[model samples]
Structure formats: structure tokens, C-alpha cells
Target: MVEFGSPVPEVVEALAAGFVSRELLDWGGVALRLTGVRAVDQPEFGSGRVRWRTATPVVMKGSGRDESGALGPRQAWLLPTEPEWPAYMQGNLRRKAETLGLDPGVELEAVNWIGPKRSFSVGNGLKPGAPVEVELSGPPETLRALWSWGLGQANSGGFGWVSA
Candidate 1:
């Protein structure tokens, strides 16, 4: 099931289409359902940070270089404490927004990893599925765009789907 702070017809329609087709290109599988959407209280952060929680597990990859200055062959998962987490999420959100012809300058103040972490198998490796709450302060339009599109890598594969 999926939920959002407000109704998003466009996102719902897109999800419905993907569900009916049982294909989402590279996202894999079509076992997702939109049970319903309801209104929720908007969180207020005194520090201009808004909390967000992932409905599905968010998966991210961090790349680095080897000792020889060549690109590393491995991609590592990003924990919330890592400085690269916010940048990674912001980049993905920006890309999605730009693809939909929306503004891509949304600001993600911070990302905090809430506990009760879990993991699931994707192909050969286990992907982490810990619930995350983030601090996002941006324009209403940009916030809406992020809400509709989702927050991190492999959104089509049901990662980083969030509610307010």
C-alpha cells in the first residue's frame, strides 16, 4: 500500500498504470498496491527541518576511487549519518523533478536514520530496509513534486516511497 499527505492524481495514475502492466521497466516486479490515501498532520521542525519516513526501504549506492585513482568496482550502501546521504537523495529527487519538467533546486536539510532496521534480498545481495526520517525544507511546489515522485534510488522498484 501507499500513502501521501495529500491527493496526487498524477502519481496515483502513474502507479496504477504500472500496476496494471505488471512492468515498470528496470524497477522489477509489480506487486505494489495503493490501498488508500488519507490526510496526516504535517510535522513542524523548529530548525526548519521536516521529518519524512520511508514506506518502503530506501537503497543507495556510494561510489569511490581505488588507490590507483581508478574507479572502485564496488558500490556501498549509504547510512543516514554519512555526509553523502543527503546529497544522494537530493540528486535523485532533482533528476526526477527535472525529468518531469519541475524545479530541481529543492533543498534537503538533513537525513536521520531511525532504528528498527531490516533488510531484504534483491538479487544476490541483501538490501537494507531501515525506516528513515528526513529534514526537508523547500517550496510547496518542490515539496509536492518530491512527495509524488519519491525520495531515493530505485523509486520505481518501491524504494523511498514516503508520506508526510
Candidate 2:
């Protein structure tokens, strides 16, 4: 369950050889023992079209506007149906790309509703965790990163885990 680049061969090697054993996984302070490691990455796309399935909920955090058109007091959960969802999600992706040293031009093409929005409880507040289909256009490397790392915010919280 590690989102790492291919250039990190030393980590790959260590994990493959079982030289890396128990380590602290930051997700909820869970500790996992490494039995094996597998490499999975989306291949370079030629058509600039890639499909993704959100295996976990994609967290889109955003603020709300008050009835008088002023910004809300606190940030709240944003759903796929919201008008600004795309831009908000895109910003998250771009930041991730920058962090990963990849191009930040990745664009979210479209999202298929598939079904109604899903709600997943995280800690106390309810978060959107609906499983949906998405299409994106970007550099192959960036797309591969989105595939490997998932999408939207709070990825470390186990949301937005997608599969190509």
C-alpha cells in the first residue's frame, strides 16, 4: 500500500528482498509487516484518455457560502455534484503532481455519476466516499501517478483510492 515512484529502486529492492520488515504506516497509526511488494503502474497513454474507478471515496474539502453570499464559518465536505468540484479536485491533483515532481497540467475530463453520492464516516463528520468513474487527460506520467496515488484530498485517509 505504498505510493512510490519507480526511481526509488532502493526501496523496491529492499521490499522485494524482505530486507524491510515491520514499519510504521501513517494511516491511523497502523503497523504492517511486509511479506512482499508488487509494482503496479498505468502504462503511458497514447490517446490522452484514461479511465479510473474510485475504489475508495474521494474527499473534496471546500467551504460554503452563507445565505448573504459571505464565506461560511467552516469548511465542509464537497461532493461530485457540486459546481466547483472539478476545479477543487484539479487543484488537489496538481499539488500532488508538484509534490511528486510530475507535471501539474493534469485535467479531469469528466465524471460519471454511476450512482448516487456515497457517504463515509471519518472520525466524527460524514465524508463523501462514493465509488465513481472518472476520465482524465494529462501526461502519461501524471496519469500514472494519479492512478497509483489515487485522487482528491485526504488520500492518506484512505479516500480516492482508484484503479485504472
Candidate 3:
């Protein structure tokens, strides 16, 4: 993810050129791979909104700050069955879009839990990985951007990587 940040197109081109290299590119100790992507039918809800689903598990982390300007412990997990999950994910995506100077009207539609949630040790503590599919409806361009960039926190760390 960090490798694909600024100057993304060039980085992607370089990676593609070295696609058959014996050495694999690793991000924070985790090896990375490039997968083929395809566009699927955008599910439509009763409200006439089109939505897209994720093909990979999305990892999210929530945290707060203390009065002394100290960072709080990170609580990472997947909230597929929670009612507030959509709002939470939407907020993160919206913030990212805004940061990129794009005003996308994206909204989370449904979350389908695929179970087998597990936790893994990250930088300082544990982070949960829940394999669940989500449906999000929004502008085609915006959705495409999100699909390529990713969703939620720690995206550069390979979290919240989504697909359509």
C-alpha cells in the first residue's frame, strides 16, 4: 500500500514490469500480490440506489484521544452485523474522498457476515480480521476510486482493501 501511494501510476508500472521477479515486494513484513479486477453489477436497493460489494476482508480500527493529547489504544475489529457499521465505514470513505478533492455521494447499503473472524498482531497490538462482504451504492466514478484506493483506516497498511 505504501508503495502505491504518491506517484501511483509509475509505481504500478514498475511493479508490473517486475511482476515475474523472484523476490516479492513486502509491505511491513507482509508480501503483496496484484490480482485481476473486474466490474460487477451494482446491486440496487429499494431506495433505487446502486451498490457494490467487497471481495476481500476489510480491517477497521477505532480509537480516541485523551485530554492530555495522548493517543488512545487502538481497537480494531470488523462490525459486519452492527447497525452502526455502515455509518462508520461511510464516514471513513467520505473523509478519504474529500481529502482527494472529490465529493462522492457514497453510502453503505448492506453487510453480509462471512464469519471466521480472527485477530493478528500488528505494529503495537492486535487487529481483528473479519471476512465479510459489504454493499455500497454511489457514483460510478467515486466507487471506482474507492475500489482502487481502498476503504476505512490503515489503508496504506493494507486494511479495508475493497473491490467491486
Candidate 4:
């Protein structure tokens, strides 16, 4: 029962992919199945608090039932698609630690995505509005790649990455 708490199409897609679960509370939808959840804490809006750590990425799955009471094939979206991308889990701290010649392999307990506030427009000046502030935590390079991947995926409506 991963709580997505977001409705962004890509995020929703990720949720649908079993990466996260969109808590469509306002939509009057609830998952009666009641399962487990892998929660990743994100900021309210536009907070640069990144929390990337080397851990198992959450997996998603289909859970029929939506806020509108729509029942069909659906899934929870998990993040960090592959288990090989370790940098996204450990942000600057790990990188900096490694750069400084320190043991980056050391574990850091607090790491999650950093959400942003004041979302202007999505793709091609399309406004999807803004939900809550989300915190995305990952190494600079990995985070950038994620943004690029997400945008590309969103723009193409197929598959790709988005970055800043």
C-alpha cells in the first residue's frame, strides 16, 4: 500500500508500475484489498531536501480500485526502476564522501525524493498544476538523469528520462 499522494501522470505511471501508490483521497477512492506499502517521504513543495540511499527500490503491482470507484487493472508504481542505479539512492553525501576519499559505502539512514513547489508547466507549456512539494534525493548526475528520463517519458508518452 505505497501511498503515492501524487497525481502527476508520470508519477502515476510509476505508481501504476508498482513504484508508488497514489493516495487519491479526494477522489473518494480506497483500496479495500489493504496491502503493504513502501513509503518514501517527500517534502511539501519545492524543498531541496534530498534523500537518496542505496537500498532496494520499491516494487509496484496492480490493485484494482480507484477513487472514482473504478475497478479494473491497476498497479502500484515503484521507483528507481533498476537495482543497478546505486547513485540515485545515495545523493551528494555519498558522492562527496567518496570524492573526499571516504568510504561512501557507509550507510545513511535518511534518504528519499525531494519534491518541488511552484510547478509552472509540464511539457510544451502544458499546466498540470501542482500537487504537494516532493523531495527528490539522488546524486547530482543521477538526479539529473532522472529528470531527463521523466520528462522524456512524459513528453513522448512512451518511455525515456527527464532531467534539469
* TM-score for candidate 1: 0.64
Instruction: Write down the RMSD of all candidates, one decimal each.
Output: 6.2, 4.2, 6.6, 18.4
Q: 99-140, model 2: which lDDT tens digit per residue?
A: 888888888888975446778777887887466688889888
What is the C-alpha lDDT profile of model 4 across 37-145, one tens digit per residue? 5534333323323433211122212233455657666432223332322333344335434544444443334324423222224345422211111245434443333
lDDT of each: 0.62, 0.70, 0.57, 0.33
Report the lDDT tens digits of candidate 3 across residue range 36-86. 322233222335344444444566654443445466674435455544456
Best by TM-score: 2
- Per-residue error at 110 for model 4, in Å? 13
Best by lDDT: 2
TM values, all candidates: 0.64, 0.73, 0.61, 0.23
Model 1 lDDT tens row, 53-77: 8777677766654445567667777
Better of 1 and 2 by TM-score: 2
Sort by TM-score, best first. 2, 1, 3, 4
- Candidate 3 stretches with Cα past 4 Å from truth are 1-11, 14-55, 63-78
Off by over 4 Å in 2: 1-36, 66-68, 114-116
Question: Residue 76 in model 3: shift from native, Å?
Answer: 5.9
Ranking by lDDT: 2, 1, 3, 4
